[model samples]
Every structure is written in structure tokens, then in C-alpha cells.
Target chain A: MQENFIKATAFAALLSASAAVGLTGAAQADSIKIGINVPQTGFAAADGTSALIGAQLAAEQANANGGVNGKNVELVVYDDQASPKSAVPIATKLVEQDEVKIAISGSYSGATRAAAGVFQEAGVPYISAFAVHPEITRSGDYVFRTSFVGEVQGRAGAKLIGESLGKKKVTLITLKNDFGQSLANGFKEAAEQFGIEIISEYEYSIKDRQFGPIVAKVKSDAPDAIYASGYFFTAGPLVSQLRSGGIDVPVIGQEGYDSQKFIEIAGGASEGVIITTSLDRDSDSPEAKDFIAAFEEKAGYKADMVAASGHTAMKVAIAALREAGSEDPKAIRDAIAGLTLEASTGTISFNGLGEVRKDVQVQVVKDGNWHRHSIISDPDLLAPPEK
Target chain B: MLAFELLLQGLVQGSIYALIAVGLTLVYGLLRILHVAHAGLFTLGGYIGVIVTNATGSLLLALLVAMPAMGLLGIGIYRTCYQPLLSRPPYVALIASIGLFIMMEELFRLIFGPYGLSFTAPPLQDTVAVFGVNLKEAELATMIGAVVLIGGLALLTLRTRIGTASRATVTDPKMAEAFGVNIGRIRDINFFVGSALAAAAGVMVALLNNLVEPTMGSVPSYKALAIIVLGGLGDLRGTLIAALALGVIEAYGTIYLGNLLDRDAIAFAFLIAVLMLRPQGLFGRA
Candidate 1:
């Protein structure tokens, strides 16, 4: 009865505050701020925007449902522009001034690492939404990511292209950045395991607006599949030019091209492109079905890997908050490390390195939509599934 | 077969670089200003071309719309920013133009964000088999367009009255005024011509690469700067020849260096060595 009186008094105060205001009221004043960063204006902006929109939609929906223990959640948005040069300053500003106790972000691996330094120095826990580099998870104590690293995705990716597709010969064309290099290395390592031969390995710069020479080389090699580990900027033109060059084969890629820009660039011609990504919305799990329905309803668009990663990161963070029974950074960090949340995408429990347990999904870009299929380990794809 | 394909691939990529580099050379040659904003102007042209292409699904319309739009912008920049500072110190104009570059870059970013806009390649997907070599649709068409444009510009400079006037004024501004030439008019027209050439290259790049970003021109700009210097500053024929050579070098370099070397560094090292040996440039008069 004494606890009930205290709760009743708090409710009465919140109601009185709502009554006295026209625009500013209980909702605005009682909001818990969460810092959000992404490349809102650079090469990776499309993916960043999609992830941000999905996360924003989730935040809004959660707020509608009385938010994080009945306190409204406010997202403090900042544009990192996908630069380490810019991300450091933004992270500093968010931490020092806005005082957001928790943050969820990252697009480029480099930018994430740069911000991770600041967050670690300040002892703030950050849940990275989509940085795939292994170095990011290794930076410091406060850094954790819901997305799988490029190494895991890379090895899994190569296996999917080589073994699942029954491809014997392949061509490797990728950007020479860390993100691209890591995937190439993973694929190379996995190739020996699967007994696949790489016919040609062509490297291109992110600034190189031409892929003709590389595609031409790939064509002459006559590989069964062309594996490109780059974003839409390079892959879109490379595949189109390859087809135009009269060399048509299946082109497999990593998770970088998972954006509407890919479809927009590839157009109807992107039929045979296969890419490896995780957290597919069309996954058969009941939680995945609920997430897909809810995400589509809230975002008015389909969920992809980045969105799935964001959902997982948020759930992990919030679950940690609940387990700790306090919103402090130390409590949240311990809580997150010990969290075993059943996210819509999959069950996630981080190891010491702060990566989700190893499991990946392979998706094919066919008829202009991401079609998810059975996991790579399923031996059925090699033969035929009984319809 | 692979070697032949790689070289041909290099030439095609080099052709686009040459086209844009020559445009930068033109603006630099006529205006004696670095015009750091040249790349931004090219990006704007690309944006205009993209919108036109998407709406009409016509390549020619996109090029036509983008060309004039970029020309008008060039004229505006000249009259507003570069013209008023004509009497001030060269350093003042340099600073002002730099500021203009920042403003233009931010404006494009505000409207178009940082993501590259996807542009569908036009109806030139038909392949031409030459001596059993399969040439790409858009690449061959672009090379043809670049050559024709370069030839036309060269003819205009040598044969036209305004072209002669521009040359005469740059050589001796006071003498050209005394000879009854409208120097300002010639400068304005040169800006239009130069900017149009850049915008044309911009549209072609979008078609070739199938993507356009506001900052795309920076790479071509540095390359053009190197080409201009290597070919002989203020030497159009030299710029053209040097651009082709740079393209071949880049292809070989990428093949060898594995795209790990800085493009500017490679172009600079070769150009600088050439400059140290011949101070006036390959085509520049001593």
C-alpha cells in the first residue's frame, strides 16, 4: 500500500504536467536520450539511412508502447558522414554535451573504430549496428556489435558461392580497402577448404569509375561465377558492363551491395546476382515473422541485414538495461556482456570479442527482390528440394 | 586474350579521365585560376543529366539539358565571384574561388546527400565486334563523343574569331582591348565553353560508371592537373596526348600496384620528373 501511494503520486505529477502544457508536456520532458550516428551524407549514406530509418521506426513504436520502463526514448541523431576525420568530433560532442549514456551506430569500419576509441576512453557502452570489421569489436571494453565481422561473413560467403552453387571456377574482383581485403582473404581461405579455384583476382580502387578492364579480364578467364566484394558504385557497373561485354555468368557478392541503390543501378538486369548477408526478414522463425510484419508496418519498407542488425543491437542493449536494473553505463556494460537475448534475427550471446555466434544467411537478388533460402549447411540445395 | 582485354579496358577508362582532364585544362588555360570548383560544377551537371534521363529515358535529351544548364552556372560564377575580384590581387581571387568551391559543394550535398545517384545506362548496350574483340556499348560511344568534342573545340580555338580574341587577350590584355576586342565578353564565353565541356564529361561519366556523386570530379581534376602540366601548360594538343599516356600508365600501375598506390602520387611522380627535365612542360613554350 505504501509502494502503491508512491507510484500513484508519481502518476499524479505526470498527469498534472500533461494538463498544464499545449505543445511541451510529459512526453518531451520524461524522454531518455540515446545517441545515434550513421553516414547520413557520404558514400555509405543509402545503407546508413535505411538502417537509421528502421531503427527510428523501432524507437517510435517502442515509445508508443510506454517505452523502456514507461520513459519515452529520444534519439539524438548526428551525421558521421562516414569519415574517421568527422566521426571522432561527432562522438566527442555527443558524449560531452548531449550526455547520451548509450549509442547505436557505425557504417564504415574505420569510422566505427575512430568513434570506438572515444566511447572507450569515456567508459560509455556503445552497440554498433553494422560495422563488419573485426578490429572494431577488438578496440576496447565499451564496444559491441550486433553485426557479424567481415571475416565470418567472408568465409561463409565464399563457401556459399563455391559449395552451395557448385561453382568450380570463380573470378575475384573487389575494392582494395580493409572491408574488401578482409572478405577477399576470408574467401581465399575458404576456397582451399571447398576445392574451388580462383581464375582471376582483379583489384579496383573505390575512386576508379571504370570496371571495364577488370570485367574484361574476368570475362576472358571464363569463370563460372564472378565474386565482387564492393559496394553498389563498383558492382552495379561491373555486372552491367560484363553483360554488355557478352560474358554472362552468375555474379556473387558480399553484404555491401544490400541497398536499394543496387536495385536502382542494376535495374531489371540484376537477375542472377547472389549476395551473402544475415538477418533476412523472410526467415521462417516466428519471431522473424513478427519482426517482418512489425518492421514493414512501422517503416513502410522491407527489412534487410542492416535493419536486422539494428533491431538486434537495440534488443541486446535494452535487455542489458533490464538485467542490470539500472541505466548506468557500468551496469549496462556488464548486463550486455551477459545478455542472451532472443532477437528476431537469431539468438545472440557475445563472446569475449563482442561478436554474435557464427551463423550467416545467403540471399540471391533474383527478379528484383532479396530471396532468402535454406542455410548454407543444408545439403539439399546441392541436389533438389522436393516441391 | 586477357592481356588484350586489360589494355583495352585501360584505354576506355583512360578515355573518360582524359575527357574530364582536358576540360579542367581548358578552364585553367583560359582563366589562370585553379578553379577548385570545377569538379562541383561537373557534379551539378551530372545531377541535371540524371533527372532528365530518368524523366525522358533519352540520353540525348539528358546531355542537351545538362550542357546548357552547366554553361549558365559557369557564367553566373564568373560574373558574380571571379569578375568582381578581377582588380584585386590574384591571391584574393584564389581565396574567393576556394570559398565558392565550398559553397557549391555544400549546396549539392544539401540537395543530393552523400550517396551516389544511380543512372540507368542509355540505349547503347549493343556490342560491336571488331577483329573478334568485344567492345562495350556505352564505352565506345563515349570515346567517340569525347573525340568529336575535343576536335570541335580545337577547331573553334584555331579558326573562330572569338577564339583568336581569347588567345590574344590572354597574351596581352591591354593590347587586345586597344585592338577593340571585348575582353569581358570573350572571358564569359570561354567560361561557358569550358564549363559545358566539363558538364558533358560529367554526363558521360555517369553513363560509363552508372553512378554519380557530387565529389566525383575531384579524382579527374587531380589527374587533369597532372596531364596539363605534363603536356605543357596552356598546350591543348599536349594535354590530349599526355592524358592518353597517363591513362595507359594508370592501367599498368593498377595492374601492378594492385590499386594500393595513390593515383595522384603515381601521376605526380612521372609528371614531376618530366617537369624537372623540361621546365616549360612537353608542349609549353620556354
Candidate 2:
């Protein structure tokens, strides 16, 4: 018994010694560690991969340009599997173990929101790359977002449909999730102001691929347009089925349908379908053009909005680190709150609530690719909540 | 016109369910195991169909390759995973089946990449007007394929020597062995037919959606399990009817009670009602 006790004590001592060494090692290293939480597996793996590549490209570019304050920018990535259960543990590890200067979430809303709470509690500055849940920034002052919240995008969709497209009658096909519910809520809130009449609202689960009943009902309603919210996997089937069911109204979607895979899955039915998203593929801005070319070349596939958002988040973090001129977490957070820069997605600026304030970019499927439809630049209409 | 369209949509959806659940029922009838890995076979068949169709641009050729390949894989699974645990409690085999299903999903993701694959040139995009209701050609093909395949299966099981042997084994494997019926061969044939049907369902769904995803089998897997239970567990004819009935009910419920419940929730609610009213299922012999 005494020998076993001695052995246990020795093991505990060795563990503490190693942990101390690890801390010193991290402090001495000439690198600014940025924690990245992304969904490298599960249903959202595709978007996660794009986001990871985008962040990596930004880091590469920063290091190539003499690094951030002469310290190389290093990303420590963890796969959250797009689950809140996974994100909590990952965020804790990033804060307590890695002691990263800042953390970025390149995952969905649920996972990002979960991670945001952990980072906020630890007083580590956190930025959401593309996850659009409003609750994320509500976590704390340390939490910020680099993308449009679902409500902002949805409100833009209402404007695009009612005022821009000159369509007054609308039907809403909502996916029953945080992403969908928020988008639907925003669209409904702004619909009346745009003189749009909501004919009907239908809700479906994320798992549903067959929208036969919804399509039939929508056809009967025969609205001037349809506003639907779903990712590419669900959107593709929904659009195809609606078209095949002989409902040829313009289908408006949000960032969920922003992938090229949506077009490929929907086939010819994708033509004329519009969405409110971040990345403007037809942008003439040098930042957008350079980022697009670099991202596509590095990723070995077409750059997506998620990728651009991830890149933008990393660029923001680097800029903050440079502005602070030190590795202090509190200083980094203050710098991030005050920093403004041009990114591939848009002009990046944070509101009082850490929510981004930028013009929503609208794109439409034409000639088998997403092209710029119009830009919504109404400051009063697009303003994010301060508190 | 709306009613007709809903009915047509339900029938098409039901046909796909029948194609999927028939295989699950067959395996359960013979082995008394849930055979959850059957869903994995369906996903594998979908991947096979997508790969072959993309390479050859022929849906027929894709079907031909996927069916036989999945049949052989089904047999292999039985030989390696099920045969060892068959003598033990049925739960042992069930646990192994679930593990295999999860492993297969991961394998698919690792091999095919996490993103879903779409057919380069999916056929039957144009609609056909049937009774003043527009139906896609793919939907028509799905209904017809289910009819032909299920009909062929009915003939095979009702009027053949192998069918008699298979039925004998399902009733009592020891008795069938005593009567000189090759029970092992019957088991092999049972798995072969079941897996082949699952492959057909997979390819049909892939074509219908024009999307093949790794987790596509997940929803169908549990749904098929529920269907078999709703059909009184291993009653083939009852399983077929239950699948079609569930499809129709879901279509109607989706429109009527959709605001109150999701499409899947509506399905389970109907299932619960049916189970409470008739514990032996709609067509099961009580």
C-alpha cells in the first residue's frame, strides 16, 4: 500500500512538472496562438473545412508579410463536430490549456454560441467567423462577430423581394432550427414595412429532403415569391421539388444556400434563385478579388462565403494583435472592439453589441454560377441592435 | 388538383419506403436480428450508383453494378459479423450491427469526402402531367420500379422451392435442417435478396434527390425499424402495407398538422396511435 502511494505521488509530481514546462514553453515561443473551433466532422464538415482553409490562408499571408508584430501567427484548431457538447470542452481547452491570445469560431450557430460563453467567461476575446446567432455576441463584451446575423440577412431578403424585385406576395418555408427561426423572424418583422403580404408560413425539419407537401401547399397559395431558409443539402432538394411541382415563383434564400453544391444539387432549377449572403463573387474591390483568387488557389476548390468569413475573422484578429502591440488579452479585446478594416466579405466594423454593421450582398444563380444581383446599403434598415 | 398531387407525391414516397423496408423485414424474419447495418448497405449502394453513373453516364449501368455489389457485401457481413454472434443473445448481433453502421458512415466520409456528391447529369428533370397534376419522370420511375421489384419478390417467396426452404428456416431452423433443407443457403439467399433491394432503394433515392450524402441512411434506418415494428415484426406483407400507409399519412399530416408537428413527428404520432389501437399491427395475425 505504501509503495503504491509513493508511485502515485511520483506520478502526480511528474505531471505538475510537465505542465509547468508547457506553460513556460508557450510563453517563450515567438508565436501568437489563435484558437480555431470548427466542425471538421459531422453534417457541417464541408463548411468547416472551407473555414479552416480560409483562416490558414490568412495566417500564411500575415506571416509572409513579416508576421504580426514580428511574432508568427499560429492557429491551434479543434474539431467541434458542430455540436455544443463538443464546443464547450474545446473552448475550455483553448482558454486554459493553450492560453491562446484570441479564439475564432468557424462553425455553426449552436456550436459557436456554446464556445462564445466559455471564451467570454475566461475573458479571452472571441470572434465568430460566420455563425450568425445573435446570442453569440450576447455572451459578453469579449465576444464579437464578423458576419451578418440571420435577422439582418433575412431583413435584407425582405427588401430584395418586396422593394427590389417588386414582389408583394410571399410565402415562407422555414427550417425548424435556430438559424431558420432567426432568419424567418427577421424577414417577418420587416415584411410589412416593405409592403409584402405573407400568404402562408410552413415549417420543416432540417432532416427533411422531400418537400412534397410543402410544395403542394405553396403551389395552391401561389404566392408571388417564396422565402425559404436551409443549407445546401436541404435547399437543393427543396428547390428542385418546388420547380418540378410546377411552382415557378422566384425562391429567395439566405446564406444557407450560398454554396455551389446547391446549384449542382438543384440542377437547372437553380436558375434565378436569389440569396442574401456575404461574399460577392463579382466584387471589383481589390481585397475581395485578391482574397478570392488566393482562397481558390489554396483550397483547390471554389471559395465560399464561409471561407471568406473565416478569413475575415483571422484578418481582424491579426490586425487587433498588431494594434495592441502586445500579447495582453484585455488589450487585444479593446483593440478588436475599435478596429475596422476592409475584408473579402465587406467593410468590417462592430456595433456596440459586437454585431457587424455592413451592407448585405445579394447574389443570384445565373448561367450556372452565383453572380451579384444587387447590394442592400440602407443604413437605417440594416442597422444591428446596439444593446 | 391539389389532392391528386398530394396523393401522387405520397405514392411516390411510399414506393421508396417499401423498397427500403422490405429488405429490413426479410432479414428480421430470417435472423430475428434488427440488421441496422442494412441502412449502411443502402448508403453504400448510393455511393456506388453515384460513382458508376458519373463515370459511365448510364443510370442503368450504375444500378446493375450497385445491386450485385451490395448483395455480396450483405453476405460478407453475415459471414463475418452476424454468424459469430448468432448463437448468443440477439442483442449481441444487434450491437455489432449498429457499430458496423456507424463505421460504414465514417468510412464513407473518409473515402468520399464530407461533402455530398451530385450526379453530373441527373435524368428525368422534366415533368409529366398525370390527371392534370404534374409529376416528375423520376417519381413515376420510382413507383414503377417498386412495383416490379416487390412483385418479383412476392413471386419468388410464394411459388418456389427456395421460398419453401426459406420459410421453413424462418419458422424453425432446426426443423428445416432435420428435413434436409439447407438452412445456411437459405440464410445466404435471404440476405442477398434483402441487401439487393436496399441497394435499389438507395440508388432510387439518390436519383430522386440528385444528392448522395454519407448520413442519408440515418433517417431511413430508424424509420425502417419503426416500420418493421408497426408491421408486427417480420410480417413481410404487413410491413409493405405499413410503409405505404405511413407515407400517405405523412403526406396528409404534413399539410394538415404541419404547424403543430414536423413531418417526422407526425409520422411517429400516427405510429403511436396505431400501436395503441392494434398491438398486432394493421395486417398482422393477432
Candidate 3:
């Protein structure tokens, strides 16, 4: 009886304290709350930090333009550390405690996929900035992806390798995970369509620092080119090791290789390495020019593909909020599902699954910078099926 | 040619493992503490080495600065974390060291902004051919530096007065203290040297991989722990042999078997087999 009395007293005090705090919060909360989940640490820290900067830039631009529905836009960011375990709690805090109306994810596929379920159950619209896994948008109606899916980019890569570059024979070095395998699957499926023959395929763990043995295998295979799938950290060293091993054929990579740090780590070996990514920094489009200038001016470095996706995701969110004219998450989700805007990457429109349909830009590293080589556009790739 | 290249690659990676595992073994010999935070020191050395390299644009300067910096840090760690917990159980010290490791990683994240730093020296970019195998100047330097440093350490332990004092303390601290050996001072010197060796390995890794991250030391450090145990707790020579053998086995395993069981699988497999055969390690005293 005494323990129950103490518990009751403590609960009353907690209620009163929270009520006071809640009143204060309601009085001062003039800005519409948007949550951003990104990895600020771990293996993907470099990409995560750039994505954070891009999201911040978008929020700043929206505020400068008087924000959505004439209210200031505020972003509450949580670092998932690129792990699903960390992302789950951050998602809960964003919805249950922070009361954020919407969320934008700038993390890898694992964290984004994990957090999408949390936001969906809570009726919050979750926009993925750059995670390309197809399962991400398939989670729920509330889950949306502003970036192209992995299969789209992979298909584009195969088309570029076979049709444009005329590389008939290729050796694939996949990173052995969802992002790598999904991309590789798309590449394999479309390789035959473009008359490209996959000579050999090999897998490498993400934790691998040395590529000597793998490169040796590739050297012996001696295909026309090598298609490597991995992030900048692995991709950079892979290129360096491959070149140092005297295998100098054209090395094609996925969007994971699209970072300035890729050039930094690979050094001169990054030159002539081709990759297919969603964003083209050198594009003459007004959206590209404006975003590049603003992001670089703010971040002190050139924006990469992931960064552009962050900016577009936030812009799309704010636009949806403006059209909805309220803080209702379902209305915002509806507005976003119907959104058709010209984003930094390309024209942004969602299919039934909320995956973005856009052109993947083929870029090649030239003289320590990414130069636009060509673009592969597929109209039916992202279109929703006719009812 | 492929076999030859794999051997060279294994030797380089094994040399780094030898440097790291040897330090852990040395600390365990004297303190009886696992010293898990030693990995944090290795990571710190890598970060500091990168900073110094960028500032000075000299690989030599980076090594010179990083080694001493880590040595000083070792002394600091000993004074604060280890010394206070010395009177407690050895396991207490071990657990505290794990805490120190976590704290150091978090501190690094806070300071370095959680981004991986690229370490590059312009002069080290050139490739040198040795025995018909192409190697970057940085890779060759790492191999040569590891050999010279290990040899120098062996000589120091076998010949020098301080080395003898360290050995005396390690053998029997109470007896050495009773004989006026100042065991505490010997332990400090031991930590300084061991930490310096780890720092050298860290800088070499940053140079070779061209990337230095805050969490990079954790895995290598844990692997070093496995090496020390597989080498019979505190056996230096055994550690060296095990390190090299594991590196070669991993390289070959990744090539022959699929990458599904390449790195940790090969190391642990060799370890389990060795344990089944000779539980005291390759060169360990039974």
C-alpha cells in the first residue's frame, strides 16, 4: 500500500511537470517541425554529414522564402549512425516525443527501412533522401523515396556499359549486401539486353581494407571492363588497387562511388572511372546551379549525389506542407503522392509505391572532377501501372 | 605471380598485426590488464598522423609527431585510468579499459565530426617494383618500417638496461621492487614503448589504406587481442608468427574459399586448430 501510494504521488508530480512543459512548448512552437534522420558517425559518416548539410540548406532556403503556409520551417535531426538499432529510437522520439509532423531520412538503406515502419505506424510521412533499396518505398503508403531506386541506377549502369561505352565483356565485383546485390541484380537482368556479357562475378565484404587478392582474380579474368559496386571508401581503394595492379581498363561504379572523397582517396587513379548517379553537379540546369552554389557556399565543399537528394527530399516535403496548408501528416502524404516538381536531379514524380522516376546521369572522373558523360532516361521505368 | 603478390600483401598486413598485437602482449605481461584502450591509442595515432601529415606535408614528420604524441597519451592513460584501478582486481582494470575505449571513440566522433579523414603523402604515390611485383612506395615503406621497428624492439628487449629492467619487473614485480628496480617506472617505460609501436602501426595503416577513421582501430585492436591469446597470452615471438600466418591465410582464404568466411573465419579457424593441437601457441612455453 505504501509503495502504491509513493508511485501514485510520483505519477501525479510527473503529470503536473509535463503539463507545464507542454504548455510552454505549445506557446513557443510557431515553426512546423520536420524530422531528419541521418548517420553522423560510423562507416557512412562522410556521406551522412553531406546529406545533413543538404537538408539544412533546403530548410534554410524554405525559411528564407517565408516557409510553408507562412510558417517558419524547423528541422529536428537525429543521428542513426547508419545502424537500424539507433534509427528505431530516433524515429520514436521524432513522432511520440518531439511531435514532428513529417520526416526525411538521409541514412543508408538499413536505417531508412527500419525507420519507415515506425513513421508509418505513427501516421507520419517518411521521405527517404538517398536510400535506393526497393523495399524502402514498399513499406507503406506513408513511406516515399525522393531518390532513384537501386534497380533503376543498376539498369542505367548496364545500359551505359553496353550501349554507350560499347564494353561487351565485364567483370563484376559486388559488395555483398542489399544495396550492392540489388544493383547487381538489375545490372545482370539488363546486361543481356544491351549485348554485354558478364565474364565473371565476385563478392567482397564491406569491412575489407585490401583488394589485392580480388584484384588479382579480376586481372586474370581480364574482361573488357570492371563493374564495382560499393561506397566511396571501398570504391576509392578498389580503383587505386586495381590501377596499381596494372588492370587499367575502364572501371564502372554505382552511386556509392559519387563523392569528392572518392577522388581524394583514389588520387589520380579516380580518373577515367565512370559511375551512374542521380545528380550531375556540372549540369547547366538552374536547379543544379543554384543548389551547387548554395550548398558549396554553406558546406565548404562541392555537393555530391546524396547531398542533392537530401535537398530535393526536403524541398518536396516543404512543398507538400505548403499545399496541404496544415500540420496533418495524412494530408501531407497525399500532397506529396500527387507532387510533380522539377528537383535538383530531374523531374520528380512518384509511382504507386512512392519511388521517384528520374534520369540517371552517367559521370566520369576527369582531371580530379566528375564530368557528365551522358544520361540514360527511361520513361516507363518509374511509371505506375494503369488500373 | 598471383601467389607471390598474395604473399607480399600478407606480409604487409601481418606486419601491422604484429606491431599492434605485440603492444597488447607487452602491456598484459606487466600489468595483467587486457588494455583494450590501446586500440583507442592506435586510432588516435592514425588521426594525429593524418593531421600532422596535412600540416607538414611530410610523412616523416607525421610519424615522428604521432609516435611521441601517442607515447605521451599512454603515460596519461596510465596515470589516470590504470594507476587508480591498479589496486583493484585485474578484471576491474580490464573493464575500465573497455570503458576508456568507448569514451575515446565517442570523443573522437565529437572532435573529428564523425567523418573519415583521407591520409595522403604526395611522394608516397609512386609505385616501386620489387621482385616483379608492383607496390606503392607507401606499402614498401610500411613493410621496411615494420621490420626495422620490430628488430629494434627485439634488440632493446634483449640488450638494453631499461629492457632488462622491464623484463625483471614482468618476471616478478615484488622481487624486482625488493631489489630496488622501481617497478612502477619500468611499467611506465614499457607502456611508452609499446604505445609508440602501436602508433607507428597506426600511421603505416593510414598511409597504406589512404583513409583514417575514428572507429578504424576497434576491429584491428580486437583482432590484436585474438592474436595475443592465440599467441599464448603474452608471447611476443608467438604473436609475430601468428600475425603473419593469419594474414597469409586470410588472403589465400578469400581467394580460394568465398569471401563469406575470409577474414575472421580464417583467423579463428587457424586459432581453433592451433588450440586443439598445441594450446600454448606456436612458440609459447607450455
Q: Whose DockQ is greatest here?
A: 2
Q: Which residue pairs overlap in candidate 3's backbone?
A: none
Instruction: Judging by lDDT, tell me the better candidate of 1 and 3.
Output: 3
Best by lDDT: 2
Sliding window of 10 residues with minimal summed lDDT for model 3 chain A: A19-28
Lowest summed lDDT window (length 10), candidate 2 chain A:
A19-28
- Interface root-mean-square deviation (Å) of every model: 13.3, 7.3, 7.7
User: Once model 2 is optimally superposed onto the true structure by TM-score, how far is the C-alpha of residue A319 displaced, in angstroms?
Assistant: 1.2
Give the TM-scores of the predictions, in the order they appear.
0.89, 0.95, 0.93
Q: Write the per-residue lDDT of candidate 2 for residues A1-387, one digit (tens) a residue.
A: 234335545765785476446433544378889999988767788899899999999999999999999889988888898999999999999999899999999999999999999999999999999998888999999999998888888899999999999999999999999899999999999999999999999998888898887898899999999999999999999999999988899999988898888999999999999999999999999999999999889988888889999999999999999999998989999999998899999897988899888889999999999999999999888888777
Candidate 1 lDDT tens digits, B172-252: 888999999998898888778778877887887777766777667767656777788888866778888787777767666
Model 1 ranges off by over 4 Å: A1-27, A286-302, A377-387, B1-4, B89-91, B259-265
Stretches of candidate 3 off by over 4 Å are: A1-28, A380-387, B119-121
lDDT agreement with native, every candidate: 0.73, 0.89, 0.84
Candidates sorted by DockQ, best first: 2, 3, 1
* Candidate 1 clashes between residue pairs 3 or more apart in a chain or in different chains: none
Model 1 agreement with the true structure over A2-62: per-residue lDDT tens digits: 3433454576577445533521232367667677788766556767766777677667667
Candidate 2, lDDT over the whole model? 0.89
